[model samples]
Target: MLGQPAQLLEREPYISFLSSSALVIKQWLLFDPMPESDARFLLVDLRQRLPVVSMNDGASFHIADGEPAVASDPAYDGSQPTLIPGQLVPTPVWDDRAGSCNWDAKAVLEVTLADCPPVSDERVRAAMELYVTSQYDFLPRSLYLAMLTVLDGLATGSKRADRIAKWIDEKVSEAEEFNDQSLLDGLRGLKNGSHAAGIRALVKRAVLYLGGSEQEAARQANTVKRLYRVRSQLSHQSDTVELDLARATQLTRLVLNAVVSNPALLNDDAGEEASLAGGRERRTQWIAEAEVAIRRAKPDCAAVEKAIRRPLIMGKNGLLIAHLADRTQWAIDDGGARPVSDEMASEWAALDESFGERL
Candidate 1:
């Protein structure tokens, strides 16, 4: 067992060294203090077994064990050495006889804090609203211009109705020109061509069916011509197209009404009542039927929304009716708006039934 004071002295080398140096100066003697009883016993046993010798300098005398006095000159001063505070001392050479000595110091510190929880429901709702707005409003507007160009092509038949029909036939024939390997590449090349041909065919058919009066045919033909001009400017001249939604809506209604009014266009029987009605009832019925069909299709809401939201849909070629339909659908869906309900569906079915089973 080691006493507390002895343990402190043994543990703190700086304090021990200072105390020993002070005692050597005052008493002119060396003292080795052992903290543990076992260490003291070993020291005493070693001293008893070893030989001791005395050496004298001019000022003081000292004893050493085992080793011979290498320097015994009286000229050596043995007075207390001056101690400089905080000065580093040179390390002594390692001696195998001294055995092993080691010193170590270690410390550790720790801290803890509470964790945070997740976000609230209100924030989630806000984020969803923002997502819907961007999809419906922003994305659709960007796509509207492309839609207009397609519509312009489809509407091109009113002016050059005859030429447009021939064009469609020719383009469809061109579609057959591609080999299996080149089909995709050839089809891509025929994009504008195919659209033009389709417009032509639509126009030719419209003209043939409605051309009984030259004046009426000419008016319809003029509309087709204007649409074609728009298409050409968009496709070849790099002209900017601005679709006037109001005008487009009016034109679409007119064309749809005309197509529906003329039962002869579809080879329906010219009944006395149909003749007496002067196509007015037929045109109204056609419009109603088309509206029902569109609702039934329930096209993409984004496409529909884009068309409705914008005053003018700009494109490279012109307005695209199909693209408008696409944008409208997008907008509707994005806004969380459902299409016509079950009631509307039932009503449309009844209307269709009144029109005839063929419709």
Candidate 2:
């Protein structure tokens, strides 16, 4: 008579017979609160067929035929069977539900393939700043400044040629110290000294004709080598070496003035016409080549802009604010017409608002 309720067990021949036999014998009690002994005894007989059962009170029982029966933990019912002690069971998490689970398999796979990290706002800002600053710094400031000065001189038709010639002679004399022995020997044979020295003498003659000193003319002659050396170093070296900002500035002034005063020495009208003609045919080809050169110059504004845009939360806003201030200066400098103080201030204010800060 000791068995689980007929309704409690799944339809089976053994369970039906047991339930009917128990009911006829009156040994299966219909107790509201079954005692522990009754529960155990019923579980034992029921274990002969079905090995597990779920009770009405949310409890569970496990019966081993010809052995002892066991009750389950209160927290877990026989609705789900588990491995017995000493048995290896693979516990699987079922995720057949119609929605994404706690761990999305597809998402994890995609992340692995892409190898992308979660981008932080700070990092994004920093990267942006770097790009902007690099663009600014890469511009050829010295070259541009020199060009502007040259253009100015050309416009004014200044009589600074003599001065420039003297400067060149001075630079040439200095450069002689680094000249190759063969060149020096050749100059020396000219007047038993150095090519630089001979060149200086020739320059002096030119200067004399111009009512200037031979010493001044010689100085101009020396300049060609010196200026060439400086330019070479500037173009090739990573380290600044002997050249500094002041030296570069001075050189810029000298070159622009010289070129402007003596345009015939640098430009060939026919050559320029030919180049322009070629460019007209190719359209963007020449422009693309020029862009490459421009980028190589490493201008300053881009670098500054990049610095202003860097991410570190504490200083990011400050950098952006500073850029706004800089933009005001830029506008004033570049405006078609001279900008009044009020206009500059208004521009500054606009930039500040755009960047969400005051410079």
lDDT per residue for candidate 1 within 1-359, as digits (tens), equals: 11111110111113224233321221111123333444444333323211110000011112243422222232212232212122333221221222121311010000000011111233222322222222223333233333333334233322234566567557656766564536645534443444444443343344333212233334434554565556456567765675433333333323322333343332223322333254343334333433444455564223231121111111111111212343222112222334445564454334211111122
Off by over 4 Å in 1: 1-194, 200-212, 235-247, 258-359
Worst 10 contiguous positions by lDDT, candidate 1? 105-114
The lowest-lDDT stretch of 10 consecutive residues in candidate 2 is: 50-59
Error of 1 at 247 (Å): 4.9
* CA displacement after TM-score superposition, residue 345 of candidate 2 (Å): 51
lDDT of 2 at 20: 36
Tens-digit lDDT track of model 2 for 1-359: 22222212121112224233221111111212345666545443344212111111111223322443232322222233222222323222331233322333233223321222222233222322222222223246454334223222222211224556566556556659887776655433332333333323332232222222234334544543454455557668777545333333332233322222222322333323333343243223323332333334433332222112111111112222122224422221111212226665565455322112233
- Taking all chains together, each candidate's TM-score versus the true structure is 0.22, 0.17
Best by TM-score: 1
